[model samples]
Target chain A: MTVEAREARQPWILLTPAVSAVLLLLFVPLAFIAVYSFWLRTATGADQVGFYLDNWREALGDAFYRDILLNTLKIAAITTVFCALMGYPAAYFIARSRGNKAILLLLLMLPFWISYIIRTMSWINILGVSGAVNSALMALGVITEPIQMLYNEATVILGLIHFLLPFMVLNVYVSLEGIDETLEDAACSLGATRWQTFLEVTLPLSLPGLAAGGLLCFVLAAGTYITPLVLGGPTDAMFANLVFEAIITQLNWPLGSALSLMLLAVLGALVLLYNRYLGMAQLMKGLG
Target chain B: MGWNLVRVWTLLVYVFMFAPVAVVLLLSFNASQFGSFPMTGFSFRWFVELAENEAILRAFRTSIVLGLLTALISTTLGVLASLALVRYRVPGANMISTILIAPILVPEVVLAVGLLLFLNFLGIPKSFPLLLAGHVIFTLPFVVLVVQARLVGIRRDVEEAALSLGASPVQTFFEITLPLLMPAVLAGGLFAFTISFDDITGTLFWKPGGVETVPTQIFAMLRNSISPEINALGTVMIVMTVGLPLLGAAIARRMAAGRGA
Candidate 1:
């Protein structure tokens, strides 16, 4: 082989192992799930391998599944909104601060680095009937009884927000840091008030990061099984919980595969839409 | 006044972020069995209990071994892939990079279920090896992203200089490129370790019968009953999760400073 041909061939040789591994493990499994979704599961917990549309019809036609799917999206949307609302200001503060940025970022990241399960479990210590919030409230005469704070839709959203807020903050902070100082200065010089300057200059400029963070948080919140399992009530179970049940508890792989594909399809559509408008590559780069 | 308000808001945000962690830390020391507040006096009873618990100990052992294995496997693959991506002109490079990192974007539940179904279909027993494969899939993207970032920052001239100085491509890579990439590789490995160690969603689905990682054990414990032992486990996990990255960062910073000096 010529030197040029050899040089051209080297990348393929180097990439083969990792690429093949990913193809076999990730892509092949996904393809399997897609195919499995079309198969049948008997009442006896055995998979009947034949092409059938019953799983899709059952998953999509039933109100129970529809409601669960909608609830999952709603919870994810609410969690994303909360993360953005809470994260943007903190990110902005850290970005604008003249010093101690590292410490501030570390503080934001500390909880995030901890296990998601542990972080969700911590809420039990804080939000349980005899937990900290109730104890504090009772002491202050805010409420006479310990209100049920854990095991609710709101608590599930809170858990997700806590888990996803750091990503939002980090992404927003990256974009915020990328903003030229002079643009804000220019807006100020043009007689815009601080709020006006922020509304026009800063918010719009940092929107890419916000959008990226929001997408990520939504995807995470929508797909999370542990948060709902631990923090949510029976009624608050998201679509993922159903998937877990069908696969693990019920041993109905066909139905579970169907639900999994449905969830993936919805999330995939949202991501594709996002990519069409704002390229995923650019958004992810901004995230970093 | 506005600046002060913003500062206070940021402080409140930090408090909100750390409140649960603080509560967990405090509860770990509490002598109370119910994990309720109101000062039941500090004690190390939970830590002792945790140390004595065989189940938790076994799970901890599993998590550490799995994490180490994942770090080793993913980082090696990630370094090679990143080298191809950054150094060589490859067709479909963008597409390849996207595929590699796609796992991070996909829902963990979807990945877990898919893997479970795939493994089951193939009659691959749900074993540690399978779980390790699943974890490597989940974590390889992080390693690639980290190492790729570092590789991008490195100038091509350095490698070119080594090549011109009678170093073969492989020798140049091992001597010149690998040394430069070490910090990134180490960071990526640490990230992979932490991710694999904390993985509950994937581990829950893929772990074989009777096998448990720390997070899975903790999840089961929490579901069954709340205990100070769980608190102790949480405390240890928090320390590891927080300490490992900080330690890695410190080492990387020191290494960078030494190179500068």
Candidate 2:
């Protein structure tokens, strides 16, 4: 082959293994899930191989699943809001810091490396009846008895916020960093107060990052069963929990497949919509 | 005054971020078995207990082996993919990058169930290899991102310089290109290791019965009952996972500084 042809072939040869692996592993398995959703689980727990809409009907039509799905979305939405509320000030602080920006950014990223399960479960040690807050409150004589703080919807949201806040902060921080410092000064010189300048200038410019972070936090929080399992009360079962129970506990892979695909469609649609407008580059920047 | 308020808010946020970690660390040294605290005094009994636990030890070994394997495979494939992405205009470039990283986009539970179903459909047993494949798919993107970022910053002139001096394409890759990308390659491998070591959501599904990584083992132990042993284990895990990336970042920083970037 000519050198140009050899050059042309190199990228394909280099890319093929990774590309095919993704195709075989990620996309092909998604196809498998799509196929599995149409099958039915026999009374004996054996998956009956046939195109049946029964699982989809039950997954979509069941009031119990519907309620849990809505609850999950609500919980995820709450977490995203909290993350943004908490993340913005912190991201702004880090982004605007002088001499310690790298350290602050590194600190922000520190929690991201920790195990998601570990991070979620860590809330138990802090909010459990015998945990720090209870112990400290009891010491202070604020209450004679420890308040029940663990295993509640509130705690579940807290766990998710703890887990997802960094994503929000990082994305906002990246966005904030990209904004020229002069713009804030220009706003101030043009007779805008710091807060006014921030509201009119910085916040609007940073809105894209906020939206990106919100999308991410919502999708991740919505998909998580771990935070709920580790921290949520018995009644706090989320949509992903239903999917997990169907597959792992109930041994009904068909129904589980349908449930997961339902989730996939919802999340996948949101991701597509986000991509259409904002692009996944911001997500990548946040993730990396 | 406003900036000071923001700084205080950031400080509190940092405290919030570290509170659980602090609790885990503090309780790991608690002499009490119940993990409740006040004045039980500092003790290393949890650490001692963890040191002697066979199941935990086995799970730790399993995690290490799995992480190493994941790091190895993810780094190799990710580097090649990164090179193709950065150096050449690969066909369907946008789609290919998306596909490569799409594993990260999908929910872990979804990916777990899909992989489990896919393997079952093919008559494949849920085993270590299954777990490894799930992990590699999840982590390969980090390697791709890290390596590709570094690769983008590297000038092509050096590689071209090597090529013009009678060095084969392979030689230029191995000698000129690979060395420049080594830091990122190593950092990406560390990321893969850390991610695989800490993964639980997917591992819980892909694992065969009786097999456990540390995270899975911890999950089992927690589900069975919370013990002080878990505090010790959690502390250890926090240190390892946190330390690995910190080390990776530090190395990258040192190298970048060395290169006068």
Candidate 3:
């Protein structure tokens, strides 16, 4: 082969493995999921293979599934808000601090490496009936009986925040770090108060990061079943939980496929919107 | 907010983040059989119990093996792919990279169900290798992102200089670019291992009947007994996952610093 031809062929050779893995594994599986969603689960616990729209109709039209999905979105939205409210000040502190950025960022990212199940279970020790808060409070004569803090929607949201706040903080910190400190100073020097300068300058500038973080937190929380399973009550099962039950417990692959695709569609739309506006690079940065 | 107030808030947030897991580290040694507080006493009974538990040990071994395979496969594929995408002219590079990254954006449960369906369609039953395949797909995006970031930061002149010194293209790449990319690859490899080790959502589905990783083991323990030994197991796995990345991060930093110096 000629040198130019060899050079041109080089990239494709290098690219083949990863691209094929994604195509053969990820994309092909997704096509399978789309196809499976059209099938039916028979009474004998076997998938009835056919071009059927029954699962999609039941998934989309059933009020039970619809309520759970909306509830999932509601929980995710609330978690994103809590993460934003709790994470912004912390991100601001870390981003603006001197000489400790690496340490703070490492600390921020540590929980992400830990097991999600462990992190969700941590709240059990914290807020369980005989948990730390109750034990401490009872010891101090604050109350007699232990409070039932676990297995509820509130704890579910709390666990979601615990899992997601670092993402929020990291995104905002990256954004805040990119804004020149001089810009904030200039606003203050122009007779703006500290509050006014931040409100008018720093806050608006970091909105993109906050939005990116919010999108991420919402998508992740919506798709999670573990938090609800570990920390939520019987009625607090989210959309992912429904999908899990359908596949694992109910032995209904067709319905599970439909429910999962419905979720993918909603989250995929958000991801596409994010990619179009802010791009996936920011998401990568936050993940890193 | 005032600087002091912000600092206080930040301190509180750190407490909030660490307290949950840190409490486990402490409670793992508690003399009591259960409960989180009142400090009955400090003992290693739970750890001792965990040490003797064969199932937990087996699960941990399974996890290490799985993590190693995941790291090896994903890192190799990621390095080659990123080299092409970052250093070479590839058509539709943006779209291609997006597809590589789509696995992360797609929810884990969706991936789990989709892959299960795909495998069932292919008449492939869930097993260790299939589980590993799912993990590679899940962890591939991390390796790609990490290596691609480092690759973009690398200057092209070094390879050119090597080429100018009469080295073959492949030889120059092996000698120059690959070595420069090693730190990120090492970090990315560990990240892949840690993520694979820590994953439960997808693993729960992709796991064959009766096969268990540490996360799946913990999920079962949670559903069944809520053993205090779980805290010990949790502590060990937490250290394994968090320590790997921290070590990798430190290595990457030192390598970068060494290069700059």
Docking class of 1: medium
lDDT of 1 at A207: 91
**On residues B1-261, what C-alpha lDDT tens digit does candidate 2 reach at each position?**
999999999999999999898888888898886866663888999999999999999999999999999999999999999899989987798888898889988988899999888977788879999999999999998889988887898999998999899998879888988888888899889989998998888998899999999988888887855678888898999899988777777887898788785
Against the native chain B, what TM-score does each candidate's chain B reach? 0.96, 0.94, 0.94
User: Could you tell me the TM-score of candidate 2?
Assistant: 0.97
How well does candidate 1 score on lDDT at residue B20? Answer: 90
Tens-digit per-residue lDDT, B1-261, candidate 3: 498899999999999999989888888888887746656898988988888989988898999999999999999999899999988898898988888888898998999898888886788878897899899999999999988888889999989999999999879878998888889789789889988998999998889888899989998888864567888888898878888777777878888899789
Evaluated on chain B only, candidate 2 has a TM-score of 0.94
What's the TM-score of each model vs. the native? Answer: 0.97, 0.97, 0.97
How does the DockQ of candidate 2 come out?
0.79
On the 0 to 100 scale, the lDDT of residue A2 in model 1 is: 100
Candidate 1 C-alpha lDDT tens digits along A58-110: 99999999999998999999999989888989999999999899888888888
For DockQ, the strongest prediction is: 3
True contacts kept of 3: 0.85
lDDT of 1 by residue, B1-261 (tens): 777888888888898889998888998999877666776899998999889999999999999999999999999999999999999888888899888888887889899988888987788878898899999998988888888888889889998999999999999989988888889999999989999999998898899889999999999888776787888899999999999899999999999889889
